[model samples]
Target: MRINVLQHTPNEGPGTIKRWAQQNHHDLYIYHPYQFGVLPTAEETDFLVVLGGPMSPNDSFAWIMKERQLIQTLMEQGKPIFGTCYGAQQIAKTLGYAVTKAPYKEVGWAPVYLQSTVIPGVPPQLMALHWHEEMFEIPREAERLFSSDLVKNQGFILNGNILGLQFHFEPEAEDIREIVINDAEYARHHNALQQSPEEILQMAIPPENRNVMFHLLDFITK
Candidate 1:
């Protein structure tokens, strides 16, 4: 399968998604439409994975608009699509939902409660990495998958093939470090939900985090 990834920034790469692709022996391609202004067509992409970024879906950038168009095309074709963070917001916006400032700027490790047993083996509540100020509203006809105390719409699933998660599930240790270094101001913000760089880096990543991500990738594509 030709799995194409839409990466918005250098720091936010595919992380464990790339690993999953490699382990599963599927062809994976990562595209930076923000930098190169190029995106894969629906015909060329068997599956699409949109990674997180610092940008907002409300931004009037041409590339952001183009990315949304690609997402819409895939949705119309019933192609599987998965998005995280800003990517999730982009998907929601494309579906005619609002993407606005969240009640709180959730950063670092936080617990998200699973609203449904869509993904088996995943705990009802698990810690996931978050680094977004804006949140996507649950689109009509989409099932709410997860929620956090600070954000009600943490994740949504549509038509069993489209998934949008407002948190970072694919980032490994190095990816988290790069994110903290590139966006240091996020860690400096003192809040109950936010954590310092040291704390974010030092805390042990739950062993099930990677497995959960792998499960999600398999679930969306299968």
Candidate 2:
């Protein structure tokens, strides 16, 4: 199956999803709308994977609006979408969901409790790497999927074709390290707690999470 990847920045690639696509030999096309100011062509795709970035979904930048338009078009075609963090916010904004800040910021690995209907191969509950200060309100006609102790509404789904995840389930060892490198800044902005690489490694489930990632790819492409 062919997948179109909309990347927002140089640092945030598909991470674990990239490995899955490569190993499975699926055709993967990538776009950097943030850097190139290019928008997605009006075309149908089997699956659309929107990666995360540091930008807000409500940013007035031209490229940001163009990216949102692309996502809106993909939804119009009934194509499946899998979005992470900022990507999730894009899906929410396109579907008339509210992207707002919560009482507290969520960073690092927090426990996300899946509410039964989210049984798409991921466990009922798992610790997910969250690196966002913002949260999205569930969109209209979307199934509010998961919740966490910290974040009441963690994710939402739209007609089985679109899934928006507030948490990062695709973090690699190096990804963890990068966050640590900027931990001081994150701590200052949100008054967040610091987590070491060792602390994050303790909760790392790379092997198990890979299985879930493949399941998601199959789901979107199907």
Candidate 3:
């Protein structure tokens, strides 16, 4: 399958998603709109994958608005899309939901429970990496899939094809380290809700997390 990826920043590239796509022999074409200032047309790909970034969907940046437009277009065309963190916010904004600052910044390994198990192979509760200060409201008709103590809407599925995730399920240990190094400002929020870099590194991602990611990918592409 031909997959188009929208990478918002240099450091926040597709981690586990890339590995899954390659192992499954799927083609991935990434467009770095932040670096190149251009977003590729999504018509050519069978699936669209939007990765996370530090920027919010509510930002006034011209490129961000354009990216939202692209997402709107893809959804109108009934294109299968998976959005993570900032990407998920973009999806929610496009669906007319409010994307605002979360009450508390959740940074580190956090546990999220599956509110709905419609997405096959996902366990009822699991720990995933978190690194964002913004969250989105669940759009109408979308099933709430994941929810954590800090964020009520960690993930949702709309029309059974579009998946929006507010946490970093695809990040590996190296990916977390790179994000910490690149976006060091997020680490300054010292509180019980937040975890230190060393602490986050010490926490291991469950093996089923990657498997769930792959299962979701296959389900979306099918």
Q: By TM-score, highest first, what's the ranking?
A: 1, 3, 2
Candidate 3 global TM-score: 0.95
Query: Which residue pairs clash in candidate 1?
Result: none
Candidate 1 structure, TM-score to reference = 0.97
What is the lDDT for 221 in model 1? 85
User: Scored by Cα lDDT, where does model 1 land?
Assistant: 0.90
Off by over 4 Å in 3: 190-192
Best by TM-score: 1
lDDT of 1 at 144: 94
How does residue 67 of candidate 2 score in lDDT?
76
Off by over 4 Å in 1: 190-192
Higher-ranked by TM-score: 1 or 3: 1
TM-score of 2: 0.89
Per-residue lDDT tens digits for candidate 3, residues 113-220, read: 999868877789889988888899999979999999878899999988999999888987788778878776676665436577778777777888888888888777
lDDT for each residue of candidate 2 in 1-222, tens digit (9 for 90 to 100): 677789876666787888888887887788898888765575746678888888898789988887778888878888888998899989898878789986577766777887746446668876678777888898878877788877777887777778888888776777666655645356345534355445654665546666776776666566
